[model samples]
Target chain A: MTEPSAKRGIAVEQAVVYGLLTALGLFAFVVALGYGLFLDEFRVGPGLVPAVVGGLITLIAGWELVATLRGQRTPHDKGLAEIVAAAAEAPPGGVSSDDDLPGGTLPSGEQAGEGTSDGVDIFGRTAAMRGRQLVIVFVALTVSVLLVPLLGFLGSFFLLSLFISAAVERRSWISATIVSFAAVAVIYLVFVVFLRVPLPAGLIGIGG
Target chain B: MLDNLVLGFSTALTPENLLWCFVGVLIGTVVGVLPGLGSTTGVAVLLPLTLSLEPVTGLIMLAGIYYGSQYGGTITSVLISTPGEASSVVTTLDGYQMARQGRAGAALAISAIGSFVAAIISLGLLVALAPPFARFALDFGPPEMLAVMILGLATIVSFAGDNRALGLLMALTGLLISTVGVEPGSGTSRFTFHSIYLLGGVPFVEVMIGLFAVGEVLYQIREGAAAPIRAGFRELLISKADLKRSAAPILRGSFLGFLFGILPGAGSTLASFMAYGIEKRVSKRGHEFGTGAIEGVAAPESANNAAANANFVPTLTLGIPGGATTAVLLGAFMINGIQPGPLLFDEQPALVWGLLASFFIGNVILLVLNLPLAPVFAQILRVPYGYMYPMILLTSLVGAYSISNSMYSVWVVLIFGIIGYFMKRLDLPMAPLVLGLVLGPLFEKALVQTSAIGDGNIGIVFTRPLALAVMALAIIQIVAPSLMARLLRRRNSSRARKADQAAEDKTEEHSHG
Candidate 1:
């Protein structure tokens, strides 16, 4: 593994990402091969598509990993940087656009250096801050999902919303509580009252 | 066609459908204005709510969001230099300049009008062509279908991002994910891993919500908040000269966008960019393009809306999605127990035509709403990300739970949300992966059928001329870009050499004199 530095961190990250994908692809291929015969009754069997897809993944991911190790930049690097820089410098008026376009991402290798730790991401958040925020949100989400079965959907999401607003977003506790309750109320109205969805009751039994 | 129109109107004009259509577009506009929440996320998060409605009504609303967001995306581009949708990115080049010059309202007005005109034009073409296209596709056998699927996958993978290999890898990964459930035809579970939840496979709708909605929310949170701009509505008026100047560009963009949109992988974003690029080349005001020319705003806005409408052609006729959002909508179709494709017209005439008809109504509603209210919608940007994102996360997870009334679906959303975030962080192209997930079972089914039809010889695909033609098209898709790049490089270098020689000749002449 390469040491983490501003200059080499992103490249190392890219390598790790592709390396993991390559490993996952191999695992899928091997597991798929273990799924039994590729053909049954002289017809296409269950493992056939999986085996093909898995093999393709391994080959492609391996190729990408090698290319990354060779310090080859993707063709999109220039386009993505220009676009992301444009998007970052401008005061963005909206949140997320659909990821269906060419300029949706930063380039993989060289461009990540430009959007490094001290740099701001496209939405203007510092890269370091983004990492922290992502971890907090992800942890909160995992906790919320686990709590859903215990605390029920409404109660757990109320706590989840509170955490996000107060902890992750750093709002006052009172504001966070209000936002959380309001959000949960809206959820209750839309899902439970209007749509008649059977949200879990758990111990709270609010929507049950 | 007239009978179909009548039936469509009868279905779409129902008060219930009209109301929901309005609601859908309204929400779509807000979604587009909000950033981070595009039509795909909007549709996926709200899809579970539509489960209780009649399929036609639900589909009408979903389709409305798909197109309505095209109209909504331009508001931010014109006012703030931030496009709410990727399709509107080109508009910002000139649109924000227009805003700086206090012509923001005029830009918004023309964009609204141009989008309306383009929508009508494209919808008319859709009504005339889709049925026949479906009829043509009806002749396709399993081999031809297989070829078409391959073409779709290849086209998307090749054009999706800078790295074709990465795009293809993501797609293959999607297909691998799709293989987790029961095997089609064999009735044997392949990767259930002894979990009851795995038996039905990774749930499609849940994954969509996770990827598009929750994942997007998380990604946006990390990006820091956008500073909202104040847009005044006092000048929300388009001059007659402005209309006249924009008319030709609007028409050109509509047709051009429709052509791009009809292709499986070429989505509205590219269409909008191409429209803007060509307009800059061909318009009389071409040089004034980035200086906030009215034609600049009109062309890309019209093109995006036109392409958004035209996307339905392939979706309805071939059951192939035109982009990621349409792919999600296609999943919505399956969720409602309706399979989309050629036979859709024959089997569900009312639903198909009614949905098409609603596009007209939705466009009309959008125009009316946007012309007077774009600035008002722009105000939505003021809502702090603090409040906005938490609500999005809650809705996404709750929506996931409502899908199956189980924690399993919620867990899937969480897992995929993380994957989606990482994929975004790594700059992976998501649409191909999404399209692959949507098309995987269909692709495999076609392959199996083709093999069976050919007595276990998949080579039968080559025997069929139509299938071979489709395969050739797929190969061309993969090969053409690199070939074109090489040609471009050679041409540029030769031109540079010629210029250098001319300069040298001039220097020698001057010295001799």
Candidate 2:
């Protein structure tokens, strides 16, 4: 019953992404054109390749946006399915739950959606929970990066670790503190003592 | 060849080189076992540290990480049905089943053996073929080189994702990003916007670390956590029967993986899947494939490892990356002031040969290490992600800053990390984008040279037979997949319509009766 809405939601998201990409492509195209796409015979300008590439990007991205609006499947949507469909058709032990297949594994031959993490499908979560966690993580990372110069690398990282472990993961303060310190110590030994990286030591001026 | 081998061993056998090699593989195993880290990120984040070492030593360690991750990925797959690397995805099919049936140790053992055998076989082929291929490539001029780069880009775009347009877009975007620095032919800065850091260009290693490390961490955090299965060391033994069944599949997978790996973008993941699919078709126990067939575990495991080794052929000889991880390795080459191409063989024979010999040594170390410690390695998964992810995040940011001791580099990592996160959510392939970025400078240089050679008529590509041949291949790569897919769709729909018509006819006759 909710399948159609879920699919529509994906389409809308894709439309937004493609729209932004189209804008970027157009901007690049215009900028490259301003730089003089072609110079003269026997020699091309610096902008020639960029102009062509930018124009192509604009066209393709715009076309993709339309296709998303039209609800059309991509030409290659079936590639991964074709490879693993035969195997997935049969159930090996009714392995359905995360607990059944450890390491948070997905079904057979599913494309590892992300390049890292190796094919674990972490979908089927409530949208609210996933969104909240993602937002929090992103915010935490931003704040940490902003704090790096001011608080110094190690000091800022220590607090970041504390926030993630204590605030995000909801661990006990003691455990979070322990984790944070351990992580900082390792970073110090590796980057500072061992490799001699000359990390920033902000106003506090420690662990440089 | 004999003298090259001697030089390789002598260089590789140094105490310092061997130590770094061990450190690399050991770290690689840990990186592979972790959820959000892979060899690409591992190499990138750790790359700055290696700059302190000798070039050959640094390269040997980095290559060790590449192949070591292949072995490490299987441990997770067999023990917990989780593939630590993309190429190991197929192993979970029969590998997990084996674990459920009290043969977890056997599954791990067989994978280690198969990977070792495949590495040996693929390395042999790489050693023999790469030099000759480089020698042949020396004859290529600007037009031919331009065609080759185009072919590389085309092949990657075709194979990277379901949407060819998306893949091409990402590649173009990478090329666009690569144009930020001053133009090679003319000293005009295209996209610097007047920043000092922008003059040098967006650092590729930092981008890689951001995309693969921090980006993956953010993505995985949303995934939360999962319970892992436990495998006891006492149960980790393989029977004689298991060995006999796996022998053929391992050999078949080795050759097949090597073939795929030599291509520009058909990576280890594809090779493993193909090997498993073919093994299923050919094996007499085909029906047992999904039900823990030993051959199933053996084939894919062997294929992924072989493919990992074979990826070096194109990377070392042609300067074109074999896959995403190798793209980062190519960046490492450039970071070390080394340019990889046909000239690399003659110019840096010691570094090249020494690096190759280390692969042989590294695999031997992996086999010996994995055989005794598969269960021990699986224990790493027990560490909570909460502790691990924070560390990874810190390392990525710090690593970026360490690259050139600039806050600008850190900012680039942070921005690209966000971009990578969004790309993952949208299912945009990262490999094509990375390959494009790595190839952009080389590609542009070729383009400019070709234009000069042909007096501004790029159409001269059609005149040279070698260039023409390569261009034809590029066109085929770009067009063939979609064409074949359309044909298949048509056939399927026609068959479906015929079946529907038969059903309607049967219903009409019944009503009349």
Candidate 3:
């Protein structure tokens, strides 16, 4: 990773920290005023302490902004220096994978850095496929919950087993169905018959 | 006592309660294994089902789940480093590090054994020390409670080392949020916003589920659920050296946990952190803290379990709830029409002893189950998040809605999830916040009652010997530990002290130099 120039890195860090301070300061100031105007107990209103605290935050933020702009750095607080140390001398500006970052992976392959593949459209396909996977899984879960009311425990679970295994579990059709059927049967017998917890009975009349 | 205990055993050893206990442990472990599920939500879901059974039976089930889940949680922390609950975060430091070194088996084995020893010691303390201990909690009337809470509030200043101001703000935010629905002094509702359900205020389970479980899901959703890190089953059990190293720390931690457990409002997590802190201070090895140390695992693990079990004393004896789980247990007591407090032994020896018997039964069951099942519980950490979160969202929706069957609550839970997510992202600890909220009303009520009893003077609190003792104990709880550490540093050999200089306060020292 190519390290960014010190000047450029410092400038970026200053902008980010100062920018956050300005935003938070403004938001807190406005909220404090609104609290005074609306909420009761204005003299010792719950908002009063919050407003004072918010004001202090804003002041420190403003102070930090000024110090950074002036380049009057404190001993313990080297915002830019810390960033440089962390980023280190690795391949600085390049994405390791187009589709992901370490903390949270992106849904699209274009994010992972392969736009140069002539007419490949890798990013769009990866993103679309990921999105489709989420939608299918969500639907399967929602269907299982909804079906619990109608198909009863046994039947609804059977269908749920099939859809989840087939769509999300990524298995052979027979294997998915078999696992689904068997698991649901176990849950059904344990919760319903053995425990005798009341369960919904469907048109199949399984509840007895 | 032995005959009564035997009789108690006879009562709890029945087929039905035993079966419920098994079911509870199984359900507890499942919920504990899942990231977005916890003992509180699990209890809330199953609490409704328990409404049909005898209160003792129901409580036995709930208690089983509460302790069982706590044990199950360490599995995740040690294996994948995805903490199953907030308290388990400390476990990850030593635990996952141990796992990475191919001693995962040792970590898992030692944790189960540590937890087992802690549970046994803690239960022994509860039975032996409960009555006289219950007498101590009674000393905390309003003024003393206020002072103690004030001190407890002061603890945030110390605990939130770097972010003191933000921590205080968050704490006050908790104290204030807890005061939202009702005016404890007056009959008037303060901030219900005209909703009937809001009058009940935010339920403890709802807030916990939102903050810990749902909050975490939001972070996971933001970061794709699949962690790149991996550790296999063979590496998951205990090594000989690991067991040898942890034995002493486990012994120390269990003792500490049981002592803290008797105190109202001091729960397992704090017990764990305190145990970790003490073990770090007192252990011959100091540098192994952030890096995986077996003592670190044993300390927190043992303390947390012992604390979890010890909390039962307050609920059983004083009728005053200690923590959230015990509060639920308190509800069970009230439902059973057997008021807790000193009268309990005289009025219903059978019921009380029987319940104690059940705890012993449950602890043994926990020991048996935790070792073999460590690998199984760890598997849930490996479950695809895509599969996990959807189910969490589904269960959360069902759990939140089912409480009052209210849609608005569902929305509130979601909104809190977003807020809770941001809190975690911003690096705020959620425990003290929850503890503040949970204890606030009780603190407020105690304060008012004491003031009234004293005819507005409040001097009666300190003037009373019992009250003074409790307040003194609370302060020592805060200061004594730190002072002892510094003293330990100062008195140790000069070379040792020089070696420990790195642990000294270094806030502006490096910067100035």
Encode model 3's per-residue lDDT on B39-99: one tens digit a residue: 6556654554565567667777888888887788787777766556545656765677777
- Candidate 1, residue A155: the lDDT equals 82
Candidate 2 docking DockQ = 0.32
- As a whole number from 0 to 100, the lDDT of residue B471 in candidate 3 is 72
Off by over 4 Å in 2: A1-9, A71-76, A80-127, B232-234, B483-513
Selected candidate, larger DockQ, 2 vs 3: 2
> DockQ winner among the candidates?
2
Could you report the DockQ of all the candidates, in the order they appear? 0.29, 0.32, 0.06
My TM-score estimates for the predictions, one after another, are 0.90, 0.90, 0.66
Q: TM-score of predicted model 2?
A: 0.90
Chain B of candidate 2 achieves a TM-score of 0.93
Query: Each candidate: fraction of true contacts kept?
Result: 0.37, 0.33, 0.00
lDDT scores for all predictions?
Answer: 0.81, 0.81, 0.60
Q: Ten-residue segment with the worst summed lDDT in candidate 2 chain A?
A: A109-118
TM-score of chain A of each: 0.70, 0.76, 0.40
